[model samples]
Target chain A: MNRIFKQDVDNILKDMYVTSEMKSKIKEKAYSQNNKRIISFSKVAVCVAAIFAFSACVIGATSIFEKVKEKLGNTYETGILKAIPPKENTIYNNISIDTAAAMTDGNSAVAYIVIDDKETVKRIDDTAKISKLNINLVEGNNSMGYTVESVGYDKNKDTVIMKISIDGKNLENKEISLEATDIMSGLESKSYDTKGYKISDIINENATFIEADKGAYNTEEGTIEEYKMLKPDEINIPINNDKTIYISNCAIKDGKLYVQYKYKAEIPNQGSLYFRFNSGLDDYYNMPNVVRNFSVSEKGDICTDDIESKNGWCYIENIFYIDNISQSKDEFLNTTIFTEYDYYKNVVRGNWNISFKVEKLKDVFEGKCNIDINGVNITRYSLSPIGITLRGYSENENVSMYDIDPVVIINGKKIHIYGTSSSEWILDEYKNMEENIVFKYSFSNVTNISNAEKIILGDKEIIVEKN
Target chain B: MGVNIVQQEYENYEIHLDELMDKYGNSILRLCYMYLNDYNLAEDAVQDTFINVYRSMHTFRNECNEKTWITKIAINVCKSYMRKSWFKRIFTTDTLKEEGYNYNFNTNIDRENIVGEIMKLPQKYKEVILLYYYYELKIPEISQVLGIPSGTASIRLKRGRERLKETLEDWYYE
Candidate 1:
């Protein structure tokens, strides 16, 4: 090799030499005395003690549990009754709302009452009633109980008659009379609108009015109804003297509402309709079915398949699924699967499944013989007719599975038959199937099996030596 | 005879300490010097590196050669030391002063100007250049020390050299 001469190289080497010499002196000064002292007494004494304590606790508990279980019969009836306390019936009370007085207190001179009795409460809910009432409570003070401006039960029908006064003169009376069934059903359902109402008459009582403009009214009934407007804010009244029935907490949130009322006898399902008109458009529509179920307790189940778009667009984002297997109303055990779907209907992200199961060995190992495969250490061993399955997570590759070869070496001889062949074994085989395999085996002939202490299969190994 | 024995033991300690210091101390100091560009900080980093090596000497397996092992320790120490708030504040401010320190030395044809320009390169390019050219390390060795693929190290070295040439061209023309 040719000798290379570079000034920069020479400077760097010279600096390195000087630095190294200085480092040695510093090292000796910093560590020589301490290093000798540290070696004299083990530095890991505390850590070793902590590990020993933890191991002893775990081992002690395991052995104690084994002895106790052996002493006491492991039968389900005996063990469960001994372990768990008896069940008790818990009584729950409902909010009793004085329907008659609540309606009379609100200055509506002529009140349209719908009492939610026990039957009504059982069929529909308080939330539905409050939402319906809010639609009728218009923002105005009138002589006849806030002048029943516009009313709707839900998104289907509305009964609203607005008579506008311009310059202290009555101009027009626009009356919207919806079909009776739509009106009744609107009151029954969770939401309602007035677009299905038939306009019977639009009389300009004040003929000399300067302008007679028509405006549109949109209601929760999912319909847009046109109305003749004589003037804007023509229906003004004293804010303090307003006889409107104030219905607070009536807004729909998370696809459900809660309402309350009091009644002695079962009140048949009955409700009122409300509507609003502005520019031939309906603002209130059916809420989306994204939230399939609602429960009082925090522990409840949710179904993602029933998700439907409100108004044919928009979806719930950041949705989380909660599963309470013990208390879930669904038939399936408590298994929560969280998922996020994009606007294009693709599951963009989320955990696929989180579940746990317990099964008896008799049910798992049908009649198939258990086989401990050679050259592999089964972290989790299960046998079925198809093959033996091993469950383990790889340090290099995440989660994976492996199929154990039917034949395995034990005490120098290859044994093919291990587990019994039965229905239980078949079920175990199918249940343990996984998407990816983690280990592979290669057989090598050896004269003395006792001499072989360890077997390597792909990236994993098994130790045959006794401890 | 007792006095002579004590004197001989003292000599032996001195020789052993000196030999160990000569072999590893400069390498550790040079690594820190390259990163910090300050003699005192470089010496401190080397001190820390040696202390760690001495403490862990018993656990040191004969996996890689001792030089590589010590170099790895020094690099890790320098990285951690650089993370200290005081060290970062001091070094970042010092970089500005050192920016033009080499500028006056390039009087012949602006060699100092070339050095200043090299210092202005991005940290990644500067590290590659210092490791490859200054330390006389091949691309593969640089890759291993830096914990990057050899191909990536080679590419960075080539790009760094080209950038240095480009930066020097402006001074040369002037």
Candidate 2:
């Protein structure tokens, strides 16, 4: 480019001063990160990794986003808006409050936040699912919470406008503070203590118990061996007199039990056939692919996979992580498992039981990584062609966690870990693992383990297979 | 005791931050303004960029020049804003135009001022031309900042210069 052209582009937009207001807010956010008191152990490592991926996987959320169907009331009218200082806004990631003001009548307040775009909108929404937006109205001694009331894309303005609303309350002479400090994780989810109800209590013997021949792990990795019932039990529970839900063959691999079942619903079916919850919220065409995951400690955790309302039939595949189901046979089957959908008053109660044994796989490569992260020693490292596990222990001090994205870089290329249902790791560990945590990384088709170079574990790269 | 030390640490940070501001503050904002072609939006972006820089100060590997580091961060911030700009445009009115902000620079009329012409160029070419000439980054350095290969950076630089040359020729001769 010529000097004249260069000078011209260089002098396009004049520089502006960095206001002290932005600096103070930045300091506040930065300090919160610094002053963090407690760190929760990462429960799902794969889910955590997926968050860092380019675009978050938008499973069964074809509903895309929840809209603000509520009518804009007087609080949103231009006449009611009383100008407030710009301090009300606090920006985070991709969402920022553009216009924040109180109402003239002091009954309610509104703030408009502009989301960066759809990708950012997804991230914010997904992240907010775990950690909600930390927006609050500070009124004297009484602090009130605000909700994302309505969302619309102002096509004329080219911004995603999210209208935030505070509860209608008198603020005649209140120095109200509407501050969004940071987005916090732990958007709370409710887990219920499932009460027991027998099959006889819920349904009659007309329901069909589906069965299959000897079951192998769903896919043929050969390394990921599956357990099948030597003699499949005939299980048929009638939803009603005319139809029944059938349970068939099953397989277990990498701490998860996959039970395949099918149900035939009449187009004009009379009985209410209750289906079990599995998988995550990854649904398509109102029918989600089975990815609903539930967690159970010695206790139980269940993510409502999906409920597909088709014209005739509903097929179900329930996979439970063997690790999470740490109880004995009697304890597990006797233990009541509750799905999230049970919260909906009208939904069929899908509380179910588990009783089966799969011939488990033999360890392909049971070993340890000869390294440490910060201070913690990584012991109990093992690998099958199907999966790899890395567990660490620190007796004296807490282990400083690193992003342990387990990949076997073989022949100058990387083979990454496959999907996971649930896991406990350094980042999101329970207090027990604060001093000791186990990281489990599973792969789908890793045929051989001895064919690679070194495995990258943050700074502590360990040579797994020697050339 | 910990609180005291943190405050002291922040005090030290403030001093260092001021020095950084003196060096690259206005330049970074100017760079963003050129990229975004909007004043207020660029200001907001620069504010966020500095915040990011402050938070990630410990993470800067110092593998490249501080200017390159700041410029890289600024470009990323501007791109992110632009990424969501199309969405923002629909709701927000053109406050800049409403305020009577114009692009005219009173240069000698004999020579065509290239600001409007450069702004009108496709974004890729415009960015490369500005980075090479205005920021004075070499093609390799520009690649590092833009996260593109050096070969691609070179081609863009050449193409951008040729386009600017054609534009100038059209303005002056035609």
Candidate 3:
């Protein structure tokens, strides 16, 4: 009986049985209107193709062009070059203050304290002479420091507020409560206009300038300063000026800022202008030339001009002459000439001019150049002297020469080329400027002369002889 | 000539669909019934399996036989139904027990007692045994439907048999 029972349980679990009604229900559900529609659509497509093919054969032969067009259309195409809309530039300035020095004059006290817990009386202490200090927080600890903890109207009362524990417990007898008048305040901010700049051209180095409160004494009730924390609109400093403006913690994005400044008439016609931005101990300069003229038009046209400083002196002779003006409503034309000057007046260097039209009104353009020094080979079908075709040997067939290189030469100088690969023969390097080496070849009309010397790249000179 | 051939192929597919439904519809329904423990839901799952099979019929490479393909569809449908949030809420134990069908066996042993013992087995062991013994599929065939190695299927069957024997022993001893 036990053996029979085990066998029955196995049979009951293993055998799956369904009634006629259930099968009918499944068939009914499977052949629902939605399912039928999908199957019928597939069948119709196949029928349409068959009928189309039969009708085409009966009428006439299909052209190879049409067939190729259909084949290419069916193939997946992707990676379209998208046009990105140009944006306005926004500048941020950092303002600095000598907090330790300010506090020593009885106006403020710089305190660096790390609170391990706000509820507990524990803190990491450090002294920062400047208003800003680099603090690295240890994991699982709450830490921070204030340049001025608390300020009081009375000199004696101010000392008490500064000495009070940050944890809010245990106030010393000498400690004093902070009054609104005793609060120390200073200014730190930088600004630049987006009218002629790309977001990349705003230099962050040495961009900070600080202004401290003026009143030393006499007004014991405390002082309210108007324009006490002013950031200068113009950052003009003499060549030998020892005072350095330090700018730290700076970021640039797309936006607008008010730019109110007159161009210094002593600005040079050529060379490059460097804006020294003081950031802490190390000074930084915004390399405006490298960043300008970075983008190209939809027709693959790019300007080869470098935008120069409007305020400084530059060599004017090397500046490119603008032959034509094609202005769009959204576009702005900006041109600058850098001067070789010792103190903003003395001249020393040669000048180069860049003239390119841009679509957007930006203060800075982050453009780069590609100079191909190797000679370009001109083909018979070429429209310009810069047009060159390089043919690869026949183990590979039908190679489009456009894939070889994209560098276009304007007059005699090489310029920016996008989306094309350089040939192995061309040597490429990017330093203060990007350079490309191109090979120049000319085909002779007459029979080959035995005395012709082959041109060697990099070092060997080509010998040209009359045949 | 190609047009005539294409017409003949469509006629063949129509006949094949009818024969397949007649042969495997009942077995697929039963597989879903055992998996979900609900007859109405099991019937819906079986129907969904056939619809999907028909829609994707063009892409079906004849690597496996028709029965294996249908069984795969049925298993996938049941698993999908189990994953739905609403299914869990509707199929709680108290509700399941109320609706569960008791097999009326005419012996001194009660049918509900037997079913109770079977349901107590782990889901994996219980599923394999039900597919193997009730569905009457060979171990190798069960492996293909469940997408597991044949060795694993055999092990599941062995463990299931052992568990069933132990449950019987404990009941008898008590």
Quick one: best TM-score, which candidate? 2
**Model 1 CAPRI quality:** incorrect
Candidate 1 TM-score for chain A? 0.14
Candidate 2 interface RMSD value:
21.6
lDDT of 3 by residue, A1-467 (tens): 24454456545434234434344444554556553321111110112222222222211212212221221122112211111111211111111111111001011111211111111221111111111222111232323221122211112111111211111111111122111111112211122212223212332334332332231111111233211111323344222222112111122212211111112222222112223222222111111111111112234332222223332321111111111111221121222111112122221121211111111111111122222222232111111111122222211111112212223332333322211111222232222111222221211100112222322222322222222
**Chain B TM-scores across candidates:** 0.63, 0.74, 0.71
True contacts kept of each: 0.14, 0.15, 0.16
Q: What local lDDT does model 2 show for residue A308? A: 39
Lowest summed lDDT window (length 10), candidate 1 chain B: B99-108
TM-score of each: 0.26, 0.32, 0.27
Using lDDT as the measure, what is the rank order of every candidate, best first?
A: 2, 3, 1
Candidate 2, residue A423: how far the Cα is off, in Å: 54
Q: Could you arrange the candidates by TM-score from highest to lowest?
A: 2, 3, 1
> Model 2, range B90-151, lDDT digits (tens) per residue?
21235322221122111211123565566555556667777877777888778767655577
Give lDDT tens digits, candidate 2, residues A1-467.
34654455445333133434334433554446553321101211112222233122222211112111111222223222233433423344434443423331232333434333222223233323111233333433344534342234433222333444333334344444433333321122222224323212322223333332223232112132232221121244332223344443244434444444444432111112122221121100111112221111222221122233243334444444433222233333333322221111111111111111111222234555557764567875655443455667765332323224466776688875422212233444446653355544544222245456666665557666332
Best by lDDT: 2
lDDT of each: 0.29, 0.41, 0.31
- Give the range where candidate 2 chain B is weakest over 10 consecutive residues by summed lDDT: B101-110
